[model samples]
Target: MDNSNSNSNSNNSHEGCYFNRLLEYTSDSVEFYPSFKNSTLFTAGTYQIEQGDTEYKERRKGRLYLFDIEKDNKVKELQSIDFNSGILDMKWTHHNNISQQYENDAPLLGVVMSRGELNVYRLNAADQEQGERRLELVCRNDVSLDPSILTLSLDWRTDNKEIVTSYSDGSLALFDVDGGAVTNRWIAHDYEAWICAYNYHNTSMVFSGGDDCKFKVWDTRTIEAEDGGRSNSSGATPIFTKRCDMGVTSIHCHPALENIVAVGSYDECVRIWDLRSMKQPLTQTDSLGGGVWRIKWSPSDNNHLVTACMGGGFHTLSSEDGTFTDLSIKSSYQGPHQSIAYGVDWSYTNSSSTDKQQYIGCCSFYDRCLSVWTP
Candidate 1:
């Protein structure tokens, strides 16, 4: 596929919002996890199973692929591993820990499986030079939850040692990598907790959105009981809850700004909220056609964001005027298509010298494809 296209505004406005497809990849199943860190992009491919397919008894596996962003702005496949189960969510640690007197230490990758298993793997440099094309991830720790409950989403703590996961059964869990145990777990919502994330600025605070149409804030410090065991009740009460027009789908905290959060809902709108006051959203974007499934803040810019709309293709949003405009993808084709954009993420590395262009990766559900572009 040609990776170049002219940059043009969606409606000829002055915001200069435009994106061009740079690369594309096809997978066997839907690609759910598209994470970018350092100079590598980590993606997991998962296939959907029929509800009553009794003939397919064997456990299905998935592929974990790694792509490196080259200096010439092209992506090269680095390695791939066939995991035991389909990955629903994956996150790369933010801290590398190499500067903390650890020799040759690379960041950890946390993988959440469809069967409710959580595993942490260390990227070993020793395996990279073994002459084999594929690099093996050294398993550092593995924690399995109740096999009946499926994990939906997960976020890594800034320390790169712990992770918090949301589940299908309206529960939240925190796992410690070094100790290989679940440090805390609680009933967080009344319905499926679709998304959960750590407030990188404050490790004690977590943000979660659920199918209950509520966005909630959780404090881990209060989850402990007075007697030093897990609390029997729901543990701690939510610090705040904001009801939305539809079920909440995604939430992303601002990378640089403290207390600022971007929330996406099935109502087809993205709302920016301030944690100090939950009375109202600071700004809400106009509809982007289909429901907003994913929202990602740019790692390089605090004011920019991108979203994967279920029916709206993909969009680039700006917060310059305290409101969201339709800076969606500009295309010659018109009208609705059947593809559902399920995953979206921004590359941590900038592709342009002036920071005018950055790499973005997105995957579609029905289409079973991954696209790398810039907006």
Candidate 2:
């Protein structure tokens, strides 16, 4: 896959660093728990199952693996847990205030199971009888009454009190983290709702993209499922919507900005948008050479955006004043993984404000490869 045809408005002269393999394992998704800043600890969900199959059969192929990011750039596996089908996405709840003791003194994890459910887990300590050191199921919320309706992705609401999940059946669900129940749901797309997120700056706002090629915005406060947790009624209509050239696959709300969101699609382009005005994209980048599967904004730097572009590889872009102009590869075809880049995440520990270098965790499907990109 030659990348000569693409255009990145800025020179990608990687003078001081190069891509290096920090781990070798087949994984479908990877995420770092911010609470482990002193010693970075992350989780990797394996496989990339499609649709939904017999849960009892596909469950054997899905496993969530834990790894610790070491001081010397090497990683070690800490533990592993079994599950029903592949994990399409994993998100650890973030803490805005460090003093509050959360569930089991650890951040809660919500995983999008390809078997049509969103499962939450808590990390328990393996030694002192604390649960934060091991992955333990907290609760399971099945978005669809039908077990085969796979959930594709999920996002933690800005307050970390609720969750919004996208499903393969073209619907969305709002799950309350503390309540461990689906508060609301509705049909939001004509095709698969590939991705969804709550705008960080607005508590009542949400955005979704689907295989139907529509980018829609909703006012969560006003959306009421016409029929208990399932509906296509006018009561659930989105506030704003626009069509994309292709299926929208990924979306990430900026951590520190208002009305700013980055969206990626099957068209292989990344677009920056200001939620206030959706008539046109604020900025658009050249083709990334593959389907953009997942996206993450640097926790410490909102200007930096990372994405897993299936065949093209993983990328890090510079977004200045909402413009994603300086695009560069953190890992690509010339590097590791040789398969569909299904998941990627930025390390909060190394990318702190005082640190100049950044570490990224990425996983590829099919071949099941997991690697860290060290600068």
The TM-score leader among the candidates is 2
Angstrom error of the Cα, residue 327, model 2: value is: 6.2
Backbone steric clashes in candidate 1, count: 0
Q: How do the residues 208-315 of candidate 2 rate in per-residue lDDT, one tens digit apiece?
A: 999999888989888765555654443488998888799999998877676778889999988888777878878788888888888888765657778899988877
Whole-model lDDT values for every prediction: 0.63, 0.71
Where is model 1 more than 4 Å wrong at Cα? 1-40, 50-52, 55-60, 69-74, 95-105, 126-144, 225-235, 321-338, 350-357
Q: For residue 275, what is the lDDT in candidate 1? A: 84
TM-score for candidate 2: 0.83
lDDT, candidate 2, equals 0.71
In lDDT terms, which candidate is top? 2
